[model samples]
Target: MDRSEKTVLTNMCMIYDDDGNVLVQDRRDSDWGGITFPGGHVEKGESFTDAVIREVYEETGLTIETPQICGIKQWPEDDGSRYIVLFYKTSHFAGELKSSEEGEVYWTKLSRLKDLPLARGMELMLRVFLEDEVGEYYIYEEDGEWKHVLK
Candidate 1:
């Protein structure tokens, strides 16, 4: 593996409303262009909770309460490296929705998530996050296109 091929730890915020609708972002300049949650890489010396809070606010313009850690997803690339992403869910927050270089942000019903353009392994990840209890890990491998194997 090349030096550039390394697994990175990342964090994502699943901002949901009391109605179970989740906030999703539409990417305007990413290869994986579609509706996604607000999140980013964990910066040096930043706690997982802090990273998600900062990322969500930066991407959505909303100051979110510290989200509860819900799930962990390992997304493997063809090069054998993967991005380890932590997922959190929070319904309590304060601020107006806004946009950033990350993408346009909006809220969508969880039931309609499958209709939106999402990252390769997001379907399975979302399933695990919604259907399972908090604190679980889901491993996925991209088979080709947007298909994946969940383990």
Candidate 2:
């Protein structure tokens, strides 16, 4: 028996400043589109940490430092592959902030997130990024229905 499985790795980083604000990207694409952090898929042979760093730079034009792995969100794809997103947070960074074709990047108060139009499931993902107690967000199917949990 071959006990092997396929997986897709991705990442998202919440870059915060000294003030009570965080960097956000207003994605232009409809697929997974909305207000979210800057990140992208991890390429082959690249480390998770390196992937996040590169993705952030590509999308947000900021170079982050000492990015702390705060949590993760994982779900199963229809093709039996697992999709995973590594969550990171950092208050340390440098460089001019710019936006890519992916979205418009800007700094906003964390308290005002609820008022913004956020991407689906981002509300839960935010818990992982902001709360120290919660470290994981998982999605699974049961009885032909989708459900989720945070750990």
Candidate 3:
């Protein structure tokens, strides 16, 4: 099996400030390192929603309220080699922000995102996720290529 034959599960949280800017992280310990939402892996035996809350707090030190399940980005494979990212969001949160070794946490105007350096595929995901639609999404590889099938 090649590098493509691997499975990973992760979660991401979009925390917005009162000014409506999104809290982003400059990742330091990830494969695709760059600007991204405050999130990380879903520890074994943890629920998706719980994972988001924990990840957000660990990375940004903000205790998030009920995180609404936004949507899912998944790459399905027969051999279980795939990536599934459960996305969550919560504007209602408390606690002072704290940066982590994971990266520098800061707030940036949502409109200014286009001018910043975003991780690969994050820009597109952010655009789609910002929309009103929260339907189930599917992304997989076929014939050595990737495809998107949204529902």
Residue 105 lDDT in candidate 2: 96
C-alpha lDDT of all candidate models, in order: 0.80, 0.94, 0.82
User: Tens digits of per-residue lDDT for model 2 on 1-151?
Assistant: 9987899999999999888999999999877889999999999999999999999999988999989999999999999999999999999889999999999999999999878999999999999998899999999999999999999
Arrange candidates by TM-score, descending. 2, 3, 1
Clashes of each: 0, 0, 0
Worst lDDT 10-window in candidate 2 = 26-35
By lDDT rank, best first, the candidates go: 2, 3, 1
Cα lDDT tens digits, model 1, 7-106, are: 7778888888889699998877547767778898998788989899999999999999959988887757777777788888889899999999989999
lDDT of 3 by residue, 99-149 (tens): 999999998998898788898778667844687664556777789888876
**Candidate 2 residue pairs in clash (backbone atoms < 3 Å):** none
Model 2, runs deviating above 4 Å: none
lDDT score for residue 41 of model 2: 98
TM-score of each: 0.80, 0.97, 0.84
Comparing 2 with 3 on lDDT, the higher-scoring candidate is 2
Best by lDDT: 2
